[model samples]
Target: MNYLDRKYQATMSVHQLSILLQYSNQDVFQLGNFVPLTALSLPTIIRAAKALVETGFLISNEKDLTELSVLTLNTSFNSKRINVKVALPQSSKPQEKEAEATCNTLMQDRKYYMECTIVRIMKARKVMKHNLLVEEVLKQTQSRFFPDVQFIKKNIEALIDKLYIQRTDQNDEYEYIS
Candidate 1:
């Protein structure tokens, strides 16, 4: 069998063991519990349980496995093994481009938001000083996000370039082009 098939089988064995433990009324697993709660055949449960016991994730009383034999979960071993697995990096796929795309999209969205906020404030106020506009933008957008002054200034320049607003004689004040 391939490595992936073996891994899948091992994962399924662990999954089945967990389901059995969760459904069983008593701390120990019994044949009667498996028969009523799950559609899995008796042979399948026995095989998985035996595999779990061999892997130190389960304990069984019988030297010879059987449907009637009781089994217990080995929680410490399970936790230790899980911790070891978590400590190991699972970087099977390359993710750098995905992360870069996400970051680029976020930056574009933020820039759009800043531009919209500047336009909205200018439209409402008709004319506003640069410092006041920046403060108002910060106050209005703070709940959604805290924007940097430089980014806000950049958006303000973009709005001017788009002819949505214009700088007044004072240079610090902006007049909405309406």
Candidate 2:
């Protein structure tokens, strides 16, 4: 295993190196393999390759002007022991996408108020059909502003996820939990 100076790590960020480590399968890898699998540029890839060579982590077989040559990892290097934090692109992460899809996607105050109206209505009417429930929730909250059926639907799904309400044996019917 190579013990690279942390200062050498500055040549390319740990995240970039981690990316290289991720797609590299065998000891000797062709240059094109990484370009399709990762966002690393030619310069960064060359730099990382050089740094790994300097650290004794990899052995470069060839270096060409137009394209990179094969490179090999040291036998002692283990990916699990790399211990570098790889940062994912912000928008690509599942949590961020989910939040964008639901939480931040809705108008908070309006969503909260609409959810309350739904609970209040469902409390009064224990069981309601899906279409009717949507209709009723919309009808009740109509005074505030017309809520999109889809937005109302998203809130209902969120409520169901929270266990505040559940769908009954009948397809469209929903019953309040409390």
Candidate 3:
């Protein structure tokens, strides 16, 4: 699953994250592991490493110069229902229930992106009917994931309640309030 959740606000760039994922399951890792990756700069790797620590994804340990800077995955980070994907060897597979749990978490993460897209569309349009809003939201988000129709309706209802939008007297159209 992608770790693009806006809630986490990852300070590390995608390449840095790729470097971090290289030692996903290892108990200890060295900073040198990132050197072979020609695309990323050393400073970027170091910043990403520090950001990961700040984000609670990794725990670092002081090490001798003979060894690469030691780091370990923070096990506590996984317990908060934040599913971070660690690369596993081909022979090992996650259990069925664990995979399902990951999927559920991924869906929730996508919902945030969808919500932002809807706001952008609605704020631009100012006023739109239910069907038109749904259509536009789907069309604009076609490159992303297909949203559930019920989910869109629920979001519309929520927007109305929050006064972000208002249902018109016609009962089918909504006008942006803010």
What digit string (tens of lDDT, one per residue) describes model 3 on residues 94-155?
45677889999988877776777767887999878889999998897778788889988877
Tens-place lDDT digits, model 1, residues 1-178: 1211122223444436444455345556775457556667776566666666666556887876687888776544533232222111223343677688899999999899888989999999999999999999999889888999998999999999999999999989999998
- Candidates ranked by TM-score, best first? 1, 3, 2
Clash-forming residue pairs, model 3: none
In candidate 2, list every pair of residues with a backbone clash.
Answer: 130-172
Each prediction's Cα lDDT score? 0.71, 0.68, 0.66
Model 1: worst 10 consecutive residues (lDDT sum)? 1-10
Candidate 1 TM-score, true structure as reference: 0.53
- Winning candidate number (lDDT): 1
Cα lDDT tens digits, model 2, 32-128, are: 5666656777655655555555555565666441245776666654443445333322324666777777865567888899889988988899888
User: Which 10 consecutive residues of model 3 have the lowest summed lDDT?
Assistant: 84-93
In model 3, which runs have C-alpha deviations exceeding 4 angstroms? 1-94
Per-residue lDDT, model 1, residue 130, is 93
Q: Sorted on lDDT, highest at the top, how do the candidates line up? A: 1, 2, 3
